[model samples]
Structures are given as C-alpha cells and as structure tokens.
Target: MGSYGTSMAARCCVTDTRPTSNPWVVLATLLAIYIVNYADRYLITGLIGPIKAQFAIGDAMVGMLMGPAFVLLYVILGVPFARLADRTSRVQVIAAGCVLWSGATIATGMASGPISLTLARVAVGVGEAAFVAPAYSLLSDYFRPERRGLAFAILGLAAYVGQIAGQAGGPAIAAQHDWRMAFYSMGAIGLLLGFAALLLIREPRRSGSGEGTVEALPLGQLARCLVRSPAYLFMMFAFGFGVLSGVAFGYWGPELFTRAYGMDPVAVKSAFAMNFGLSGLVGMLLFGALSDRLARRSMIWPCRLSALALGAATCAILMASWAGSFGTARLAAIPAGLLGGGWSVGFMATLQYMLPPRIRAASTALFLAVTTLLGFFVGPWATGALSEMMGHDAAALRLALTLIIPFGFLSALLGWAAAGRVERDRAALHDALSIRPAAPLLARPAAEKG
Candidate 1:
C-alpha cells in the first residue's frame, strides 16, 4: 500500500478509548434523529394539497413556501452551526437543533395563512441546518474511514424512512383529522427524540493526524481551500445537479400522480412512499458497501459508481414521470429509487476522506449550503414557476419535470470528471496539512496523479 493507503489503513485498525455508549448505539440514535428531522421537513410536501386549499395559494406561492421559506434560513445558518460543532460538542449542537426544529414544526400547525406558514418553515430550516454537517463529522470520529461507508449508509436510510413518514404518514394523519394534525404529531415525536438524543448519545473524541492536533481553518482560509480544489468544485456542483431532479420530484411527484391519474392523494402518496422507501433501502446499503470495497482498489470508484448510477437513475425517473398508469409508474419507481438513492453515500464518503477532521463539519456545511441552494431552492421553485407559466396542468408539470432530466446527465458527467481529480486533490490536502504522504497505491492518469 502507498502512504495514503497505509495511513488510511492504520486509522481504520487503530484502537482507541471507547465511548461510554456503544458505537452502534450512537449510530442508531443519530439515525433516529435524522429520520425525524427529514420527516418534519418533508411533511409540508405531503400536505401541499390541504395547505394550498386552506390558504388559497397559487402554485408559485406554494413553491416559495416549499423552497425559499425553509432553505433560506437553513443554508444561511448551516456554516455557523457547523463552526460551532467544530469547536464545541457536536452532540449538543445536533440535539439543540432537533429541539428547535421540532418546536418550529409544532408552530407550523398553528399557522393561519401563507405568511405565518412561511415563517414557521423558516424556523424549521434554522434547526435543521445544525444537524447534517455535525452529525456526519461526529460519525467520522466514531467509525473509521473504512467503516464509514456502511455507517453513513445506515444513517442514509433515514432519508427514505423519513420520506415515507412525511410523504405518506402526513397525509394519513391529515386524512384522519386535518393537515394541522400531521404537523402536531410529527413535531411531538421530534421533540421527544431530541431529548432522547441528548440523554442517550455521548460525544466521542475527535480524530487527527498523530503528529499534532489540527485546528479548523478560519472561514476565509476554508473558502480558499475549497476553491483551490478542482475535484471538490466539480463534486459540489455534481452533487447539486444530481439531487435537483429528485428534490423536484419529491416535492411535486404526489401532486402529479393525483392530477395525472385522478388517484386519491393519500393512495398516491402511500404507493410512492412504499416504492421509493423499499428500493432506496436496498440501494443505499448496496452502494455504500460497494463503494467501500471498491475504494480499496481506487478512490475514484465511488465517484465512478455515482456517475453511472445517477445516469441510469435519470432515465428511470423520466420513465416514471411519463408512465401510462399508476402501476406502471410504481414499476418505474423501483429502478429510479434503486439508482437514485445511493448517490449521496459515495459523494459524502469521498468528501469526508478528502477533508481534514477539524474542518469536516464546516466544510460539509458550506458544501451543503451551495448544493441546497442549487438543488432544494432552485428545483422546486423553478418547477413551480414553470408549471404556473404553462397553466399548471398535469402535462405542464410533467414537462417541467422532464426539463430537469438534462441536469442529471450534467451531474453524471461532472461526477466522472471529479473522479479523475480526487486522488490528486486528496494528496494535496495531506501535503497542505503537513501530514506525511506515502507512495502511490495505484497509478493514476498522467494529468491527475500529481
């Protein structure tokens, strides 16, 4: 093995002082918290029909509520919170965020109009911003790089499970009572989980190069470092574009099903949730494990895998959107879910490997802020605006979704490009951190082997 490979292997094999709680237990707690976090965020998507009816809003307005209202505060606060996590206890940062977002979710149930709902959503964003970066950083300390792929995969399951809860469970609750009840129930559950996270999870010691403790870079230095890395830049945009279509579909897919097939909202969402959830579960685990094993041979494998999977996924989603019937749509969803679900696992694992420990959380936060703006903010809002311009019909919605297909293809290309740059960039990071670099593990392309 080369120096980079040897260092990574050593990190993986070294035993350290164990945390008070088991690492698996810690992972479970983080997973639960993450599930609740996403469930609260996506509940609005599931309740769009009821909320729109109650507020008498247009599709453009609904888009604003779904995209800007939540994402504005989320992307804005993410870096600051991640910096705090880098300096303080990540567990506390995450727990506090869970509590804040849960409370805001409850407030969403009480909104009387669009303005109030937007405000409540903004608060939810504020809390959610604290979770992802810190949680990923903390997990790195608990599980070594070799194991992180599986650990993150288990955590990644929260996204699909949460989607099921919010996209499916929300409508079910609203059906039983009203849309407001959905928020109430999800919020209450989140609040309890927040408290549980604080009580149950213990903070692990941060890992670093054995030569010395590495401190996080200041905001300016961090920005410069990210800008300097061609691989990071490519991957960041690739991730952004990769997720754009999926986010649009998640926000609008249920409504499309209802309008296109005249299916009941509850039934449509339930079916969507089940198809997506099961397929995603399998895909996440499979790709995560595959990435880890393949990466032993080459770091570029993760990016290569992501690019291929995303390209295939784009085709699947296009088919699902234009399917003739709900059954056919469900069939299409199986491939879409399987292919689309694991993109983040490889992206994130590769990113974590490239960055130093001190800045991992903050760097992740910065990366997310950009991607969230590109994916979360732009996807839903642009789709809604296009739908409204096109008369807000089923065909218009389908066309809008179709337009997003090109972005997925673009993402795949960029991911492939990123693969060529990752090993070089990772080596540069090691040099910049003053860590010793080992011999080459595998020969790289002449241009990228630096």
Candidate 2:
C-alpha cells in the first residue's frame, strides 16, 4: 500500500506550477489505459449470443462465465498481486495486467466451448484483479487530497468509457464480422495500448520519505489493522451490498430484457450490454462530477446523498424498465444507470479516503477478496439460481434487481457516515504517525503508477 496523503507541502509542490510534473496528465493517461483495460475485459459480454449458441447451455453457464468463474480467479490472485504492487513498480503491474488480460481475451476468441471460454475469462479476471488496487494507490500519489474526488471521478469514468466501447462498439464490430473477431480485435488493441502506457508514463517519485519499497505489513498485522478501521469495513460493506444488487442484475440483463420486452435473443444480448454501457456512462459522468463538486463545496456527504437518490430513483426505474412499454423502458434506462454509475465513483472515493497510502493497496486487496466472493462470485449466480428456482420468471429477475435499491440505501448510510469522519480520520492518522512528504511526490505526472 502507498500513502494517500503525501503531505500538503508535497501535494502543493506537484499541484503548483507543474513543478516539472503534471498529475492531471498522469490522470488522463491512466484513464486512457483503463479504457483499453475495460474494453478487453468486458468485450466478452457482447459475444454471449454466439457463445451460448456454440455451447448450447442456458443462463447457468452464462452466470458461471460472468460471475463465479471470473471472480474466483480474481479474488484468489488479487491479494498476492496487491503485495506485488506494493513491492514492484505499480506501473509495471498495471502494464502486465493489461497484457495478460489482453492475451486471455484473445485466447477466448478461439475458444470452442463453455469450458474453454470460462478458463479464458478466468485469466482475464485474474489479470484485471491486478490492475485496480495498485492503480488507485498510484492515483493517490499523483494528486492532492483536495483533488482526489475529481481524480477518482476521472478514473471511474474509465468504467463507463471502456464499457461503452465494449458494449456499443463491440456489437457493431461483432455484427460486421463475428463475436470471435470482436474479442481478438479488442485484445490486440489493448496489447498495443499497454505498450503505450508503459512508454508514456515513467514511475513518479515515491510520495512519502521517497521510499520506493512497497508497504509491507505482515498478514496478521494487516488483518488486525483493517478490523479496527471503520472506513475500511464500511467501504467493503458498501461495495458488498452494492454489487449484490447491481452486478447480480447486470449479470442476468439479457435474459430479463428478452423475456420482458420480447426482443430477439441476439439483439437482446447486444442491446442489454449497450443499454447498460450507454446509460452507465452518462450517469457516471454527470453524477460523478456533480458529486465531486458538491463534496468539495460542502463536504457533507455528497456520495451518500447521491447513493440515496440513485437507489430510490432506480427502484422505480428498474420496475418501469421491465414492466412498462418499450419506449418507457428505454426512458427508464437513465435511472437504471443512475444506480449503477452514481455510487461507483462516490463509493470509490470513500474507500480511498478510508485508508492511508501505506496500506491502501493491501486494504483494497482485502476488501476486494471479500467483496469478490460475496458479490461477483455469488450475487449473480445466486440471483440466477433464485430466478431459476422461481420458475425462471422474468418478474423474478425484476425482484432480484430491486434488491439493489435497499442495498444502496445501506451503502448511502455507510457513505454518509464515512463522509463525516473520513477527513478527520485521515488527518488524525497522519498527525499521529508524524507522516512526512516524499521526494518523488513532486517529480512526475500520474505517479507513473498502475
């Protein structure tokens, strides 16, 4: 884990007059690489129809592909990689993850059936597991705390941007060629992008004490420390419940849309992905920016309010999106995306604000393991199981998505509480530890990090 608060003096040095390095430039580069990261990772969803047709399996198999199979590998490897990120160059880890996932996605293009594709997805998830935590730590190194919400918002935008390309662009590409080509082409693009990321960004100087060695807490000590941090617990809980609601529904999106709207299966596959892809982008861009501005101005828990708003609004929209007429359903999509994207950026900020730079990556890996199992591995799979148990009803799936609303309400509570104490905790910890600014904190753009 790297230190998040690199000291106001060091932060000012970087933020002031460029001082030779630009955090914003670093931020932009990370965002671009993230776009490719996402495109390679999510392009598989656009190929669901062809994959299913080739395998002749049902939603159960799809659930495995999107959920447990991917998550299991992601969680299993994420912690160790987090440690690696702390030890090695985070930029290197990110670049390696990009290459690994891209290679895996390319392999998926050649998969003959369910097991092969599932294994390939496993590799993709494992690679992705390495990217995010270290990247966040690097980002904290890149910018000052005051600018963190915006920095995080920009990084969060990658989720939407990458997804848009994967969903909208992927379908068009798939339609023109084939699903296999879609995977192959995106993977190839990502491989090239990884090289660019590696070349464009050099590792920034370390922020505190200019120490290049990664944060190294013993496993027991790390676990004990995390247990004491309310912020960390709340962060994990927020994401845990959030994912249980949102990711679960997202996993089953095509089936729900097809059953409810009576669309062609192939079309639903693409449409479902694109639907989420587009609306999610808008919600993230709008709500994320708005939330950051409000947080900066008022600091009264903008993320919490945003979460509450999205939960309440999307509950109605989720129902409408499924039950209403086609046009109405399309109209409801905006709110649906509000729930998906709004909390993501805000929640991420909360998580970052909760931990110190020294332990953030490890903390990230810890929560990721828990949340990955609780949400990605089981949420979608259980929803599908419940949907199946309920006679595989579309209405049942709708009911499953409604779970997000209440879970989001809980996340709002957590976010609200976190907002109040996050800065206080950050300050208290820094003062108590007599934290110092690092030499590298003033040197480079984007920390040349993961």
Candidate 3:
C-alpha cells in the first residue's frame, strides 16, 4: 500500500525553485480566502434565528440555505475548475474565485428576503466551487507529502477561526452593527486577498517525478476515471456520511441549546465559540497530525483504522445529545468535536491516497462533488425537514439530529471492510511511492496505478 515518505519542511505558498518571490503571500492569501470562505459559508447560522423571524421561514428553509443551495453548484463547479488548475495557474483561479464569492457575500447582506438569500447563496457556492480543488492541489505541490498535513491543518485552523468568528462573533457583531457589516467586512477581506494571492503564490510545476508519473486526466473525463476502484466507492460513502454528520452538528448546535437548556443568545454564543469553535480548533490540528502518523505506519489509513475508531466515537456522541444536563453535553462537546474533526483526516487522506499525483485535483473535485451533494445538501436539510414533520418541538430536533448515528456506523463498517481487503487489494498500490517504472519483466496493469 502507498504511504507518503518522510520529510520535514515548511514554507509559505512560494515555490522553491521557481523564480516566484514570496510563497508566504500565497499562504497568507489562501488563509485569508479560507477565513472569508468560512465566514460567508457560515454567517447564515449566526443570523438564522433573526433571519427566520424576519422572513417567517422555518428550520427547513434555514437548513436549505446552508445545504442544497450552496452545495449544488459547489459540487458541480469543483471539478471543471480543478481541471483548469491542472492546466493553468492555480493562483489565478483562486483569485478569481475569491472575487466572485466575496462579492456574493456582500450581495447576501443586501438580501431582503429568503429567495434573495438563497439566490445569493447559490452564487457564493458557484464562486467557492472554483477555489478548493485547485488550492489543495497547489498547496500539495509546494509542501512535501510529510508536511502537507501540517499545512492543511493550518489551513483548517483558518477555517476554525472563521467558524468561531462567523458563528460566535457574528451574532454579537450583528447585535451591535448589523449582520450586513459582518458580511461586508468578510467580502472586503476576500477582495483584498484575491489580489495578494495572485502576487505571492507562483504555481509549482505539475508534480510527476519522485512519487509518481503524472497521468493527466482532462476536463469532463473524471467520471470514467472513478469506476476502477472499490475502495474509492467506499471512501465516497465514508466521506459523505462523515461530513453530513458534521454539518448537522454545526447547524443545529445553538438551537439545540436553546430548546433543551433554555440558554439565551449570549450563553449560546459562548458555547458555540468555546465548546464547538475552540474544541474544533484543537480537533483539527490533532486529528490532522494523527492521521499523517497513522497513514505513515498503515498504508491503508485512508480506509482503515480511522473509520473504525470514528464510527465508535460517533455512536457515543449521538447519545450525548440526550444527556440530562447541559453541562454534561457541554463537557462531552470537547471530545465530540475532537472526533468530529477526524472526518477531515479521513477525507484528505482519501484524496491523497486514492489517486496518483497527476489526477489529484480532479479526484479532489469529484470527492467534493459527493461531499457537497450528500454532506452539505442533504444533511442539514434532512434534519430540519424531519424536525418540521415532527412539529416545532424539542423531541423532533432530537430525532432528526440523532439519525446521523446509524449512518456514521454504517460508514465505519464499509471502511473496515475496505481495510480488510488492504492486503489482497493494496499490493498494486505499493508503487504509489516513487514514479519510475519497474522492470518490464514484472509490469503491472496501468489501471491499478492509484
């Protein structure tokens, strides 16, 4: 089975051999975009109660805003833009995306009602669709496989900070200055960083050397490329369920506190920031590092032990939701967040493991497609829709959020099965290390390259 080799190095987005002057600028630019990315993506949660009250919408509509509306275009746009990133300067694509989405966030602030908010959200999804596949690919080229986890974890740090700021701070900021100011500020930061990313991060030459040869997959051709691997299919479902459950927790967390514990807005904000935000921050870093270490030891970490552990943890977390005391669930939140963060470890590992170097971006895009279609689109909306059908009561919310437990367990089972096949299945994957061909006397099939 394949595992990234050992190396210890770090740098901003600046390329090593390239004439490009400052990679840190790229790092800063991407980090800034991530901050804006998360802020725009999540600001709705912060504003949800007020927005719902203003528009007379229910939790279902609120769920849709965070899910299907944003996720649909996000899934669609991801691959095509990733194709462009493989062919062109990733920096340019990211800059353009930043501009599109940042502007969209501002328009969201201008939204007077639900339909406009939904439409503006679609635009935000479209814009963001162009960013991630390319950004992940770009960052991979600059950082060695060993260090990429840390870089990505740092990138996730920006997201966690944004989550805390967007969710925890937004309500408070909106209370003082209006949600419009928060949206405008987030958008403005993106616009400024868009230019900066263009300046600082030079695109590295496409990777196809030590680890592997580049087998370029063209745009519109990614679907066929996905059919070869059983592991990929399992990973898809695994990643989908993991992300879906995470979004459920993010969307309903504050409301859960309100309905169950009768906490006021201020207390909710504190929990959102300290419990979810702070805990999530620690979770991301810890899980990222842990996955890398495990992946190094176990070639099949992507579909291996991580999933087994995650499934068990998820079951316990679901029960925590029904805890008699808010303080108990509050204490439980720290470990729950830590385990929840493990999803990214598996998710990113799947991307890195399932494809060879050349097709990484396209594979990532396709992966995002599943993640979007299932995780973002269905998860939150399902919770809210179920909640409405059960009536506007606490019991309904409890039922809806709790459904994720079974799905998470199901995902873990699939991953464990995939891991069982690692010895029989992953022998072909061992050469995923160095790119050069073995002797013609022992040639393996090309289709098994990843």
CA lDDT, every model vs. true structure = 0.85, 0.68, 0.71
TM, every model: 0.92, 0.85, 0.87
For model 1 the TM-score comes to 0.92
Candidate 2's displacement at residue 244, Å, is: 2.3
Top lDDT hit:
1
Q: Which stretches of candidate 1 lie over 4 Å from their true place?
A: 1-15, 18-20, 209-215, 435-450
lDDT per residue for candidate 1 within 1-450, as digits (tens), equals: 335545433454223545445677778999999999889978988988889899999889888888888899999999999999988889999999999999999999999988899999999999999999999998888777777788888999998999999999999999999999999988998889888988888876677744234455679767866777788889999999987878888788778888999988889998998898789889999988998898888878888899999899988988988999999999999989899889888888889988887778999999999999988899999889899999798999988888875699999999999998897887666555454223222223333646
- Candidate 1, residue 140: the lDDT equals 85
Per-candidate Cα RMSD to the true structure, in Å, reads 4.3, 7.1, 4.7
Lowest summed lDDT window (length 10), candidate 1: 436-445
Ranking by lDDT: 1, 3, 2
Any residue pairs clashing in model 2, and if so which? 2-357, 2-358, 3-357, 3-358, 4-357, 205-440, 207-438, 209-438
Q: Write the per-residue lDDT of candidate 2 for residues 235-310, one digit (tens) a residue.
A: 6776776666666655565557777777775566555556666777776677666766777665446557555754
Which of 1 and 2 is the better model by lDDT?
1
